[model samples]
Target: MSRGAEARQGLTLIGPPLFYALIMLAAPLAMVVTFSFWTQDYLDIDTTLTLDNYREAFSQPIYRVLLLRSIVISLVVTVTTVILAFPMAYFLSFKVKRRKTLWLFLITIPFWTSYLLRVFLWKVILGYNGVLNSALQGVGIIDEPLTFILYNANAVVITLAHAWAPFAILPIFVAMEKIDRSLLEAAEDLGDGPVRRFFRVTLPLAMPGVMAATIIVLIPTVGDFITPKLVGGTDGLMIANMIQVQIGRANNAPLGATLAIISMVVVSLIAVGIYLAGRKFGGRVE
Candidate 1:
């Protein structure tokens, strides 16, 4: 193809999606930004430019606390999910010599159900009169039901980790599968132990998938409100829950917009930091 024709074809391929993003994503984000600088009256929106929303968001202790808690929870969930998934992914990639597709299908069985239903199932499993407590009682393991398992930050982390497991596994598995087996054999021949081989060879090669999985889980988990809402009681409430309150019953859209923007900024910074750190570590490995 000629240069001009190629250019036109490229534009043709990208133009529709770019325009859609402009309309659906950029435009809405712009509106939220604009709204954040405005104020809301009793039943009307005061479009006058002001910084009160941001000032309140930063000055308020609750917002800061919730934002920090959300970050912590997200980090915990990401680490837990990645740790748990690595073994499973490793098994599937290296050890599972037969019926790999069946195991993978089973791994995705949870996804066939609604996300809300999964949350509710966890709630049922963790609640005071839930399955776990009942099972414990039935087995005579405890005289009383365990109240510490549900409706808290721990629950949030566990739920999110479970929910995001597949996301973490798939990328890591892909990365591990793509690794040349000869490198591992060569490392073994060189008198490297299994642990050393993994650290110096397998782990480094799998970093790309691990990084992708981390980013995928971290971003969404930080902003998740549903799991927190269903399983997270007062102490477990996250920034997203507060934002939802502001936009919902609180009738303070401006404040909600401000909080949302702040969250986006914080998440963006974290994602960038993680990417840079991973890149540096990967460079060291190389």
Candidate 2:
């Protein structure tokens, strides 16, 4: 085919997806950005551009506190999920000799159910009169149910970690599978012990997957309101919950848009920082 014809054909193939993204993603993002600079009255929106929303978002102690809490909670969930996932991914990638597909299917059984259902299930398991309390009582482990296990930041972290576990595992498993086994054998031949070999060869090569899993888990978990709403109680509520309130009951679309914009900026900065830091560390290791 001629060059011009080839270019036209390529554009034809990608045009639908590009248009879809423009409508679905870019257009909504633009609206949010525009609204962030606007003001909201009780019954009407002031379309005139202003920084009042951003100012309030920054000046308010509650917004700052919630934003920080959201970041911390997300970090906790990301670390916990990745750590827990690593072992399963490792076993599947290196140790599983048969039925890996079956094992993976079982791992993903949780996804087959609705995400809200999973959150509710965790709530039930952790509630005062729930399965965990009943089991502990039956075993005589405690005279009273543990109130500390539910309705807090800890509960939020646990629920989010559990919810995102499979997401973390898949990326790491793919990364592990891509690793050259010959490098590991060579390390062993050079008198490297199992632990040393893993640190030098396996872990370094798997960093990309680990980083991918971290980003995937961290970003969504930070914005997650459903889990926190269902199981987090007051102490567990994150920025997303506050945003929901602003947009819904509070009827302050401008403020909600501002908060959402700020969140996206903060997440973008953190993600960039993490990528840079990881790259620097990886380069030093090399």
Candidate 3:
């Protein structure tokens, strides 16, 4: 086939899905961005492009606090999940010699149930007079149920970390799987101890997976509203919760769109920074 014909054929194959994606994803995003610049005039939208929404998003103390809290909660959840997941991923990749598929299947069992059900399960475990507290009382560990575990930021973090654990594990496991085993043997041959070998050879090569896991966990956790609503009481509420309130209860779509845009921008910048840092570190390792 001629190059022109090949190009046309490729376009024909790609065009339908590309158009569908633009309509489904790009159109809604563009509409939100456009709305963010306009104003809500009581019963009707003011259509006039203005920075009032953006200015309010920045200036308002409540918005600032919620945004900052969301970022902090997301960071904590990302770190907690990745740190816990790394050991499991490493074990799955290096220690398990058989039934690796079975172990992975077990790991994904949580996904079989509804996300809402999982959140509610955690609530039962963490609630006052619930499983954890009841077990503790039965064992004489504490005289009373603990109130701090649920209906707060701590509950939010624990739930989010659990929810995102699989995401963290899968990426890191894939990265570890791709690592050349000979490199570890070579490092050992060069008089390197196991710890030293892991740091110098295994860890560096696996950085791509770690970076992927971090981004995967970090981005969605920032915008999580349902988990917070179910378990995170007032102290645990995130910017997304506020966005929900604005759009639904307050009936202020423009302000809600502004908050959503600001969130996307901030998350995008953080994700980019992480990606660049990972690339730089990988380059140095090479």
TM-score of each: 0.95, 0.96, 0.97
lDDT of candidate 2 over 43-65, digit per residue (tens): 79999989999999999999999
Q: Which structure among the candidates has the greatest lDDT?
A: 3
* Candidate 1 lDDT by residue in tens digits, 181-269: 99999999999999999999888888888888999999999889999999999878999999999999999999999999999999889
Give stretches of model 3 more than 4 Å off: 284-286
Better of 1 and 3 by TM-score: 3
Worst 10-residue lDDT window, candidate 2: 277-286
List candidate 2 stretches off by more than 4 Å: 283-286
Candidate number with greatest TM-score: 3
What TM-score does structure 3 among the candidates reach? 0.97
Supply candidate 2's per-residue lDDT for 224. Answer: 94
Better lDDT candidate (1, 3):
3
**Candidate with more favorable, higher lDDT: 1 or 2:** 1
